[model samples]
Target chain A: MKTLDCLGRRCPVPVIELAKALPNLEVGDLIEVLSDDPASANDIPAWCRMRGQGFEGGSAPSYLVRRLS
Target chain B: MSYGQSVPPTTNLDSASGLPLHPAAREALLTAVDEGWADPSRLYASARRARQLLDGSRAAVASVLGARPEEITFTSSGTSALYEGVRGLASARARVGRHVVHSAVEHSAVLHAVASLDTSVVGVQRSGAVVASEFAAAVREDTAFGCLLAASHEVGTLQPVADVAERVGSVPLLVDACQLVGRAAVPAGWSVLAASARKWGGPTGVGVLAVRTGVRFAPGWPEDEHQHGRWPGPPPLPLLLASAVALEAAVMESAQEDVRLRGLVDRIRAAVATIPDVEVVGDPVSRLPHLVTFSCLYVDGESLVRALDAEGFEVSSGSSCTSSSLEPSHVLVAMGVLSHGNIRVSLSRTTTADDVDRFLGVLPGIVADLRAQAGV
Candidate 1:
């Protein structure tokens, strides 16, 4: 599990942080992002889909995802 | 003549709010209703009472803008405030220079003013933010002023105002904070700042212009005596009171609302991304909390907006601002991005979670419907 803390952050901050962190993850690795912005709930999942990765689950203030092969 | 009336939906999922007016703000407006009619500048006793309300309002607005009371002047609208500020700077600094520099993605008001200026404009990347170094390179020794917005109104991409200030060096920096003030704090070192009360929470027809002391300008060209003759005539006291109250309300709730709205905008980007042939515009990470924008390929933005409106959504498109001319959004066009079917969702402090969920629920379906109808 690789973690990127983006709590209290807004758009593109969480998005940018995740983009930077994505490369470090191996196949099937987990990337967790903590954020309070409502958009992150949808943004991370969409980002994962765009990159062909898997987004697991998250509540407001916390988001978790898995990187896929 | 016999057709039945079709009313619009009260819940605007496409808007930043479920309700047009936030409860607290509405209450504030009501509790202080009496002050709404008083004239702050007149010599009558009632005017004195109005003056108290006006002073407090000015102080409240000044607090959010990070400027002194003497520096702040109220205007009728955001567009007018920006025009006046840009023009004032251009006129005041003409002795020192005749050239002006502004980001390519500036608001229409700024762009129009720039068009009116005898100066050059520096274009920006598709991200809608000017390259700071490139902007600095564009400035000449005879540069009269430099103008930069706190953020792009259409795309919601934030500009590095402080960095731009540094780039301006000795030149005056006219900062358009219309989309930024009350949501994000103004960056320090601006020579002049402008904003609209409506963009935050105040009523329309109230704009703010804050000029730092000692900046000289030609006041007679389009002079108003309102703000030290920089603007003319007596100010609108009721609207100013409303503006101040709205500013205070926004300041109080901004942190929490920003968090909520950011999430909402992010969700919008995510949900919209699921649809085929959709491209979300702007810097994904570096945007305002309460705004998000996107475009659909090969679709007309006006039609998309009308479709959304028909589906109980009250949203706007950057395309509509250019509706009459049928030109694409300058913000999107400047970014060299797609301009078709562009829509901008801007939130108010009154926005709700349910409201966003409703929008997310309706948006993809609306897009799908439009796509099907367009046969794309």
Candidate 2:
């Protein structure tokens, strides 16, 4: 699992980092984002859904994702 | 129709933010400002005249809403009415149950008003309308109060207020009709309801709250003789009268305007979808006729709004970046939709077909430009 630290960040920044980080990992690799920003909780999952990546759930400040394509 | 301004902006598509006072309201206010200046509570001759205007105002607003004049209480604003509606019902039913139930997409006013109570927020579909079964399941026999919006202020989706009300049994419901009063008929089966005058091209300082005759309510504010102890002090009689006049005119023209605005909105929805990576949201079929919302991938709302303003169009946005709070709109999040790069364009009686056509032409370029700048 790879962890992207987005703590102390505001909206768009955290999701932007997540989008940027997802492309570098292997197809099956798992990634988690550490974001205190409230919008990230929903935006990250929505991004995965929109981009065809896998969303393995995690709570606020710790959203887990999987690289798929 | 003029505010005595020298230069009017090119076009305004943000009527939902608050319509500038209606021409009718403006005309009424010009005369009422002097005639309504006296205290309606006093016994003087001028005071009696003010009292007559205030009474007539309530009766006029109530007639348009299908409510009785005495049932209406003019609150300081729509938010205050929600507080009075929710808390008063719960306060009156203190022994019944502490449980309050509402749709998750309710306005922050309802959410804030119910913060102190035990509450259940029922989830909604992607289109932002609540499933009646799910909503009914959340209501308990002991539930003190329930709330639902007549239509979404953000997405303009209409809720199943009537169906949910039918299944909730005897629990008193507070229908927040702020977005529906003048746009369409407020679905029946509410024990109490609240609406904003500003949404219908009325003056800012007025909100109408109507309680059905049988519904029990304790005054949420410090008990006062004014407004049936529901609100404090005498309301701004002139503006309140103007708000009533605005609502009467709005409701009268709503049916014809409904078709006209919906045609323009459909054009916007179809036009917006052609843009790359854009998502037009809200219920396509079941929504307010004049409003449409959409989100552009990777484009921040403020940038999109600023760019549109530069192009001489004005609209509203719910994306996180536009707000000082830095939180995405709860309505969008609740619908599990994109929260960034959002715009809400709501038309009005003054918005012409030419205005919408001009907007549709510029919008795609605006989104594309913002997205390209972000390298998305």
Q: Evaluated with lDDT, which candidate comes out highest? A: 2
Specify the highest-DockQ model's number.
2
Per-residue CA lDDT of model 2 for B1-376, tens digit only, reads 8687665366888988888898999998888998999999899999999999999999998887788899999997898888889878988999998999999899999999899999999998989999998988998878998899999999999999888889987888899999888899879888899999999989988888899888988876676667867888888999998998898889889989999999999999998988876788999999998999998777788888889988889888999989879789999999998898889999999999899888988888887777667666
DockQ of each: 0.02, 0.53
- Per-residue CA lDDT of model 1 for B77-115, tens digit only, reads 888888888778877787777788888788878888778
Name the runs in model 1 displaced over 4 angstroms: A1-69, B1-8, B13-45, B221-226, B320-322
Positional deviation of B51 in candidate 2, in angstroms? 3.2
Candidate 1, residue B286: lDDT: 80
